[model samples]
Structures are given as C-alpha cells and as structure tokens.
Target: MIQPFIRVDGPAAALPEENVDTDIIYPARFLLITARLGLGPYAFHDRRFRADGTEVAEFVLNRPEWREAPILVAGANFGSGSSREQAVWALLGRGIRCVIAPSFGEIFQANCYRNGVLPITLPPAQVAALSAAAAAAHPFAVDLEAGTVTVAGRPPIPFSVDLERRLALLNGWDETATLLNAYGADIGTFEERHRRHQPWLFEGENDA
Candidate 1:
C-alpha cells in the first residue's frame, strides 16, 4: 500500500535538464526489475554513476549534501516517454516523494498519484527559485493538505491538484480503492440489477 503523503520535510535536489524521460529516470536495461522497493540505485543510473559503477561526484544527487534528498526540483517535461511506472518506482526507491516541474508527461503524472508521489507543476520562475533553494542544501516543505511548497526566504508557493487526487495522496488510497470508496453503493446497485436481469450469470455464485 502507498504511504500517506500529508507532507514531506527534507532536503531537495535539482535536475535542470529538460525532457528527461522514463528511460533516463530508470534505464531500459533494468526493465527486468519487477519489485518497486530496490530501484533507487537505478534512478538516473547513467547520470549518477560511471560505467564502472563509481558514483558520479558531479551529479546533483551524488554530491554529499544532496544525497538521499527527498524532494526533487526538476526541469520541464520531466518523465516524458513510455508509460513506465518503474520510473516513479525508481524515484520512490531513492526516497524521493515529490518532484516539482513546469510540466510532466500526463501518464507519468497519473502514475505518480497512484504511487503516492506528488508531482507539483509550477510556473518556470517559481521552479527556478525552488531549484536555487535546493542548491543551497536547505530543507523544503511540501504540504499536500495546504497545497503549498515552502522554500527558505520566500512565501509558500501555492499549487493546485484535483480534489480526488488530493484525497488519494493524503489517505494513501490507490486508484481502485479510491473508486470503490466513492462508488461502492452505485456498483452494488448495478450488480443487483445485473443479477436480476441475468440470473443465469449468478446461478452458481451462491452455491457452496
């Protein structure tokens, strides 16, 4: 199950590169990975490490101050490309709960919601400000309930998320769970109607 995402308070990192796709987030070679928990090392694998497996000291995340950062300030069109949920898994594996950007791949943003990660879309200037704040190695606050991001030396930056999505993040409910919680009665009504109209479909369902 996804963890409740009321707020996240911690250091943040910056990735100013635009158009960083799913393959860049979680390389294609590791597509064999099926589990969600251990993909952290694979997030930005190529950019974060050398071919010989040594850490790329210059990469934002590899630096001592930003390593293990939980919030990421990214460039435009982040997570563009194939609809790979694994990409989100990779960030989650690395302990990243939030990514702030100007724009994102639609499917990737949806995947982020389903997996309990918040993808905050802000104007380019605000994102740049956050990225600069991130570079200072200071902690940032991402409050889902308040719909704001708190960076040092500035007013809380406001954001907007759909109502259903906001509740899903706060309550840690996956898509199916959220839908059921919202429409369980309606679904039951339909099922009852179906059973009445097509008794043959339920003929053996009640048998022990």
Candidate 2:
C-alpha cells in the first residue's frame, strides 16, 4: 500500500529554471537500474556535481542549509520531457515530499501523486514568491487536506488537486486498491453472474 500524504512542513529549496525535463531530474543513464532504492544520490547528478566528482557550489541543493530540505519550489512547466517514473522516485529518494510550481508536465504530475508526492500548482507570481521565500531560509507548510500552502508573513496560498487523487493520497490507496475499494460489491456480483452464465468455462477445472 502507498503511504498516505496529508501534510509536510520543512524548509524549501528553489529550482527556478523552467522546463526541467526528466533527464535533468534523473539522468537517462540511471534508468538501467530496476530498483528505486539508492537513486537519491543520482538525482540531478549532472547539475549537482561535475566530472571531477566535485559538488557544484552554485546549485541550490548543494547549499549546506538546503541540502536536506523536503519541499521544492520550482519554475513553470517543471518535469517536462519523457514520462519517466524514475524522476519522481529520484525526488522521493532524496527526501523531497512536495514540489510547488506554476505548472507541471502531464505525466509527471500524475506520477507524483501515484508515488505519494504532492505536486502543487499555483500562479506564476505565487510560485516566484515561494521560491524567493525559500531562498531566504523560510520554512513552508503544505496541507493537502486543506489545499493550502503557508509561509510566514504571507497569506496562505490555495491550490487545487483532483478530488479522486486527493482521496487516494489521503487514504494511501494506489489505483488498483482504490478501484477494488470503490467497486468491490459490483465486482463480486459480476463474478457470480459470470459463473452462472458460463459454467462450461469452469468445467475443466473440476475434472482436473
């Protein structure tokens, strides 16, 4: 079962560039690995470090204070590119629980929710404000239940998520589990009807 996501409170890191594709989030080379574990160290590998194995000092994630920040405030069209689920896995592996942006790539946004990560879309101005606030070491609290993002000295910013996705996240149910929970009785009834209407289908099983 997926873990429920209700709220997250922590310092935020900023990636202000637009159209950060999946390759940048988790490079293609790392896609060979099937396991999600240990992908954290490879998240933003090229941007976070250089060929000599030295950390890039200018990258926000490389900053001493923001290294472990759990929230990310980014620019518009974040997660653009191929639909690589590993991108979300990489972020989660690195302890990022929430990403606030003006917009996100279609598949990437869905993948975020499926993986128990909150991807909040807000007005461009509001996203920029959050990015600035994070740069100054301000902490952010995101409440999925309330649909609000709160930073000190600013009014709470409201956002939207699909109702079904919100419920799934709140209940820790993946797609298959959500479907079963919602239509268990109907499924059972259908099964019984099939058994009665298609007894021949099950005849060979009894003989075996």
Best model per lDDT: 1
TM-score of each: 0.87, 0.86
Candidates' C-alpha lDDT: 0.91, 0.90
Clashing residue pairs in candidate 1 are none
| TM value for model 2 | 0.86
Tens-digit lDDT track of model 2 for 1-208: 4778999888899999999989999999999999966789989999999999999998999998789999999998999998999999999989998999999998999999998999999999999989999999998899999999999767888999999889888877789776788899999899779989998876767553
Off by over 4 Å in 1: 184-208
